[model samples]
Target: MIREQATDKRTLKTIRYDADLIVVGGGLSGVCCAITAARAGTRVVLVQDRPVLGGNSSSEVRLWVLGATSHMGNNNRWAREGGVIDELLLENLYRNPEGNPLILDTILLEKVVMEANISLLLNTAVYEVEKSDEETISGIKAFCSQNSTLYDLVAPLFCDASGDGIVGFQAGAAFRMGAESREEFDEKFAPTAEYGELLGHSLYFYTKDTGRPVRFVPPAYALDDITKIPRYKRFNAQEYGCQLWWIEYGGRLDTVHDTEAIKWELWKVVYGVWNYIKNSGQFPEAETMTLEWVGQIPGKRESRRFEGDYILKQQDVVEQRTHPDAIAFGGWSIDLHPADGIFSEKPGCNQWHSKGIYQIPYRCLYSRNVTNLFLAGRIISASHVAFGSSRVMGTGAHVAQAVGMAAALSARHHLLPRDLTEPARMQTLQQELLKTGQHIPGITLHDDQDIAQTAQLSASSEFILTELPPDGPLLPLTFSAAQMLPLPAGPIPQLTAFVTADRDTTLTVELRKSSKPFNHTPDVTLETKTLSIHKGKQEVDLTFDSHIDEPQYVFITFLKNEHIQLQYSQLRVTGILSVFNKINPAVSNYGKQEPTEDIGVDTFEFWCPERRPAGQNMALRIATGIQLFSPANSLNGIQRPTNQPNAWVSERNDPNPALTLTWPTKQRISRVELSFDSDFDHPLESVIMIHPETVSPFCVDEFVLCNDRQERIFHKTDNHQSRSTIRFAQPVETSSLTIHLKTNHEKAPAALMEVRCYSVS
Candidate 1:
């Protein structure tokens, strides 16, 4: 409410703020967007309409923060998201294992406030937009109802991470609402006819036992009839949290404009459902349970999707397309729901996953119509089908991270959002992201200033890759195609495969080089071998004269024969991966019984029906004469193990083991970052419902950093974090650096992902 001091221009006063970036919304994506830009030295103004942060994942909504790992249930193989969100997840894992939404709200708020470059405005809703033109948003006017203050926020660049694209809509940016027709984007998942109905919103409630008999009296709005509810049979009194993501509504109406109406409907459904559980004759065990918390706000699924230069389609995700300017990656299934939501008689949602992780181009992050505006989170440029996959909070966090880095780069270079899409600039942006521990899946970091690339790398111990660890049950790889695997730079002696043939048959396995490393497509056949196998489970071996001179790729392909089947492991392998036939129809949740390998696990092309012999390699192995473990492997830019377990360890006999990196010339360094082993092989659950007897810990307890002159520049005697960064007060020049470590209390051997040094510019 702005009061005019006087009619004359001389008596007018205004409250205004200027920042490098303005982020609208305090959701997970917006929080990451603002924090990333601010951390990279950009002034940001973060505006959230709610007093509490974390839009959908807040206490008001209470949706779990899901990402590529998919709650550690989807075994997409080493697909956890890193960077700012990773830090939050790791911290939450340590602090709030119970997965309390209130704790998460404090975590998000504290993260935003700790950044000195960010100005946070909670309970402020931006309703007015002042644009320089149709193509640029110059500023915005927001009202903080709590404080009764009017805010004028101006910035060079703006991001609409509000999940509804409100800023982009106000700025007149091109956008689409609801679902598209099948022919629109040639999307198989789209509806046959174009419809205005979109995926609905969800409301959740938490119920806990009071340790004694409790009675619940239905409120006036409580639902009475249980026969109308189709999912009543699926309800369990003990279930809470995101297990109720399907208690949704309001897809038939505008999710944004009719939010209040939708919330009311959701509230009715919630209380009604609870009444059926406690008051209805069907439930007796719920007598001791009482409603603890229920959501006032609904967690939305889809609304207005802003148009970018390129719109991601279902094919892009299913095909796992690798973009030239890929800035992010998503692995969640393409999950879409019916417009009627909970009212729909059919299943609530349908989903389809990719063969492997897919890439998200930078072109899909900024607006095609609004030059100065950027978009992240659920509102990014994607068709409804594509949005189904990228809508998850973890994937949205990745999108926000890219937008933040791009915002920082744009602010520093005096370039617009679209201008940063140039190849060189985009590459630099990717390098910066990787430097900050955001894994881009396919992209490799090449920093010329990194002295480790030219240093004489030596470690006290190295992890030797001699045999494959026990693997999960194998399925038949009988399709008329082949499976692929990558070999280290070493010699290959005899290739082995476990198989059970219906009859005596000859099997041919070809070794080739992969043309595309991301897709793992075999290009040329380097060697071929044919072996005869019997009917029972037996070991089949083929000798090949192939030697990998450099860190190149070697793809393994087994000629398809219906009678001949390749034997694979029954136990799931943690860090190693193999690509199976692409043309074969995907088996949804092939091995759902295994907790570590559940639904969305089949998204990767690594499953085969053939079972491997016990104590044998899962599929194949090499008695490489060449050394697999060396100091050089640590700085090869391959951080997390995807296809193989890679690391350098010290000899067990050595009294003092350390890794020393020495360069030819001294270099100015400002920061040293270390990524230690977090036991990627053993999976951890985000929502722990059942307490386990033991947990695996992978963080180093203590470490010391010394320069070439033996002068201690940084030392941490008490470290329990997976990723650690030591920034010197001022840049220190050094030719060599060494890390002395104290073994973890758990007695697990020391393992690391990467050790990187950076010169702050």
Candidate 2:
């Protein structure tokens, strides 16, 4: 082959891709968004400027993904954001429990490439936006440096998850970058100009032991003096990567345009910090350690927040306000970093948590001015204070999942993003999100198309809250412990707890419940009982004469007694857990929160559950078995636990745990959706943290489905996810359907959250 002479005007190879939706940025938000849209029957083009997907969570940046679960630091029970984010996290745990950032990168790339409807363009930066008329974005121009190719992506719907609202900015969408004043949103927690108007960028690094002395020589660019860093004394060999999240900078500068400068500053800080740890003569243990990896780019926090029809403000999060068009939820605290970042004399971060998770309105997901643009990730319509909570990767992923589903819906109906704000369309949007395992706070799925509603459901054995036998280890009461119970609007039940007391003392048992039904915070005390205990182990009866006005979760609180050792049961059941009043300093929790001033934050106790293998239920016996876990709960259309245990749990030691649904007449069904308990409460942080189990003990690992003739139609094994959608290759006509679930662990009983059957595939 012979090469031709270069022409006067030479251009790069241009590729044109027509899709139903175009997604910018390949962060967790953009990845989840593209995956959701592709799964929902929309042809999508996902454009990511980086070499790999997962922006901050990628190996390049290496920040852990956290959201509603808030590191299990607060009182948000079973509060993990679901949908695509859960799937990604679960998969990461199964494949890379060590949290190898490279594996996670592969997982994100695999998820995108696996979707046949999606065309992924990595290392492709969108430089120009083409408008169809005045308000709508018709197409985008992107160039991939790796391939030296220019791509023209055209789509009817567009989602901007590009951290700094690149697409929205180019499309003339309304946006705000800095903080809003206290008077603007009545947010007393709003940061002043002296403290910080915006959260800054953070860079992370990894360290490893070479098993031998590895000398590190500081580069010319590395800061020679580490004493300049305010918290340089706190650095250690163990506190690398995201553990040193406070190593941030560049809030005063333009985070969008001046990202390079910001990254350089972060690099300088990281290298300087490492140099201090290596050569500062502080620790002999770090002599064998070497810098494994340093972040190439800074993980951005605040930038240009695009405007939507409604801006989510401080009150919406603080007051736990419900929106009519609620599509998702967020539970992370209003966490703001100091403007000075690493050099700041002030604390690294200021955080305030709400008692419960708040709903996110659909109106805040799409641009107000840019008609065809969908706002997502950190750029969604939210005040600076509110953005502090919603900016996390998991929350951003959840929000972008809604945008993806909405994009799919918009494509089908040929309607603009604003048109979905209608009441009927909003309901449909929420219903669709629920079907996809996306949890919307205070919203229950009531799909009219589900034919399983007409069937009569019966289980082999429905679980009754009788007793958690004291068959396991006896643990000391390091903190105030409580057994969370879902009760009806009636007299409180009598409970018995077995405990070994070191010395004779008086035990104070108080019954408390949240002011709200769905909330798990024990803010209101219902009744109290004090019992005299002996030095030896004995059972104490907690008979409280308390009644509630409504059905809710009540905390049978056992006040902290260091001398006492409470018995814990290994028998784990779905939607039932015991919590401890403790401090998780990551979220600013210190036993109990008592703000000195009215900072638009609540003063409450944090009763959070311990991680599995440790968060076993306290052994207790009930006066009467609570008749809450009924077989019909599977048809209640609620997938996750809310005010009560919305799952039908099998009785302990049931030889055959099965649920049967019978219909009067035979019907053809092509699709079936089954939802199980997967410990939705667990945060499943995607980086650094090692989990005890890859699958939740509450998750049903094996299950079988049979038709009227007892013919095994479908069987699933090695199941670890919350939602399982079974599509029949051929339509099956049957008058009845039976589901047999097998327990994954001996501790956990078989549980089913929801079962939906549809005629359409």
Best by lDDT: 2
lDDT, candidate 1, 1-761, per-residue tens: 97856554562234689999999999989998898999999999999999888888788888777766543333355676777777776666556667777777887888899999999999989999999886889999888877778889999899999988879998999999988887778775674222235888998989989889898888897767766778777777977767887887887898989999999988888998898888876888898999998887889989999899999988878777778888888887777776777777866766565655688888999999999999999999999888988998888987899899999999999999999778888899999888777778778778887766777887777644444422434545455344334456666656556677888877778887643444333445789878777776777666778776655445666777888756554322223335444331222344321224332222233322221122122455445522444566568676665544445554333455578988787877898878765544222334423213122244556788888897888878656455798888998888888887666432234555678787755
What is candidate 2's lDDT per residue for 1-761, written digit by digit as tens? 98989889988999999999999999999999999999999999999999999999999899999998989999998888899999999989888888788999999989899999999999999999999888989999999999999999999999999999889999999999899989988889888875667778999999999999999998788877887888778888888789889998988888888889999888888888888888888888999999988888889999999899999999999899988999999999999888989998778888889999999999999999889999889899999999999899989999999999999999999999999999999999999999999999888899888999999988999899899989988998878999998888899888889999999987888899998889999999988788899999998888888799898899999998888999989888887889999898888888788878989888999999998778889999998978899988898878888888999999988988999999998989899999989888898988898887888888999999999999999999999889899999988999999999997588788999999999854
At residue 737, candidate 2 shows an lDDT of: 94
Question: TM-scores for all candidates?
Answer: 0.82, 0.99
Q: For model 1, what is the error of residue 490's alpha carbon versus the real structure, in angstroms, after optimal superposition?
A: 7.6
Off by over 4 Å in 2: none
Candidate 1, residue 376: lDDT: 90
lDDT of each: 0.72, 0.91
